[model samples]
Target: MSWLVTGGAGYIGSHVVRAFIEQGITPIVVDDLSSGHREFVPDGVDFVEGQVQDTSLLERTMREHDVEGVMHIAGYKYAGVSVARPLHTYSQNVQGTAAVLEAMQRVGVSRIVFSSSAAVYGTPDVDLVTEDQPTAPESPYGQSKLIGEWLLADQARALELTDGATPLQHVSLRYFNVVGSGTDEVYDTSPHNLFPLVIEALIEGRTPRINGTDYPTPDGTCVRDYVHVADLATSHVAAATAMAEGRELRPVYNLGSGDGLSVREIMDAMQRGTGHTFEPVIGERRPGDPARIVANGDAAARDLDWRMRHSIDDMVTSAWQARTAHPDISE
Candidate 1:
């Protein structure tokens, strides 16, 4: 029995793939390679080059690999850019999720773990975001992820209504800012993520810029919860194992650090970790950026063995080492 990981060629998905292997579970990867690197997929793993939106491809892959569950991580994940590309975001996230669900139903696979986002709680009023927090997404990307969660719920409900049908055992993991690296083999390569952006600037002998320094925070910049990618990947494995063992789980869990770090503080850490001492260029706040958004991971810790295994320095140093190790892939 194997689990199919959508977008397993990408940064986060690739780490999850390795985590599954370490736990003695087989993983089949399906990726379109739009933003993922083929080399990121380890050797000997079954990989299908295709979009998750293609139901036939997903169904065929599931049957071919004897897939018992799915870790759906493929989506247009840029929240800020989604403001200008709502249709693209919805098509990739919402429609893609629908296709995955359809394929699962066709193959009689009843388990899924969706990669959701904290953007679902747009500028949450509460200081510490919880699973019970009301969702008010600000960007199209956030809305699309929220809709993806809805699709899972709706599909499970429909299955429940069917007689003699196995109920869907599913969970959605809402991630905040996922940083750091699980292994030098696979690191965060996204041009949009903060860690890579800053690392790229340092490597190119350029000063990184911090957008919006006048926010209502101690550092006057947007504060966000950051979690190590390796720690995050472990939780995915935990969730999958829990479902396979018939353990009950909440519909949603936030894989977040209970605290936050401002963009300026991140810059400081970057300088110390990368040995590039330069003041960041202050820029105007990008539209739709929340001042601060941290989350409580108590539920995930209890159910999914979640915890902050790495410090900010660990996140920075590991990311730097991994990125610098792959000069050919660095942009």
Candidate 2:
């Protein structure tokens, strides 16, 4: 079946694309290449170099490829940036998602897999967050995603003008800390996340920036669950397969490793994995960063029969390998 994967050349999107390809599925990629690298997109897959908000372009791509479904990974995801530039985040994330939904309806493509975030449940009272947990989005980034989710629902039910009841079903996967790399061909270009920033700092012989050293956690740093990209990729396959088999309604699932690891633990793991002794500088906290946020991914496992096979060590090691192999994230 033909599928459209927005941001398919990006880190997580590429993994999903590769996983789909391995299962004898052909996916067309739509990436504007703003933050995503072109090298991540494999040869032979249909690739559209454009943005999700480009409605005419999206319609053309879907029509040309006969796209049956869409996997929307196209969004601005930096929490700090979202705080600084709320309008831009909403425009790119919320508005872009709406456009994708409209284009999907116009093209008669039904299913979508949304890449949501654990940040939606910002600073949960408990570390392990379930999908039913209250949404208290801390930043515009998270709020925009929440808005996107609402838009997805509206699109599915055909509640708006230009409207007709759509067969469009969506599965929003709220994931946390997508780390590790299956291909050395693609490494993270943005150094916002903990893993890549730490690895790059070590390679450059500089101290890594560890935000907020005064959290209530054991190590006094914000704790998070880091899920391996490969494992998360498997779950994406599960989502696609579930929809392809005809799940009637839209569902949301949380993807996580079901554990919490602190910044100290992450530093130690990176040091061990990269054989580097670089320490991180504990600066002031990043604005809108929650104290501790982990995932209670039992719902996904229960529904999709998905489980994480890679450990935290595996995530660090794989990321370390890629950083060591290509320190600059270049081909």
State the C-alpha lDDT per candidate. Answer: 0.93, 0.83
Query: How close is every model to the real structure, measured as TM-score?
Result: 0.99, 0.95
Q: Please estimate how well model 2 matches the true structure, expressed as its whole-model Cα lDDT.
A: 0.83
Q: How far out, in Å, is residue 238 in model 1?
A: 0.4
| Candidate 2 ranges beyond 4 A from true positions | 159-165, 248-250, 327-331
User: Residue by residue across 84-182, what tens digits does model 2's lDDT show?
Assistant: 999989989988998898888778887888988888898898757888899999999889888888888877666434445456678999877788888
Q: Where does model 1 exceed 4 Å of error?
A: none
Model 1 clashing residue pairs (backbone):
none
Clashes of each: 0, 0
lDDT of 2 at 237: 74
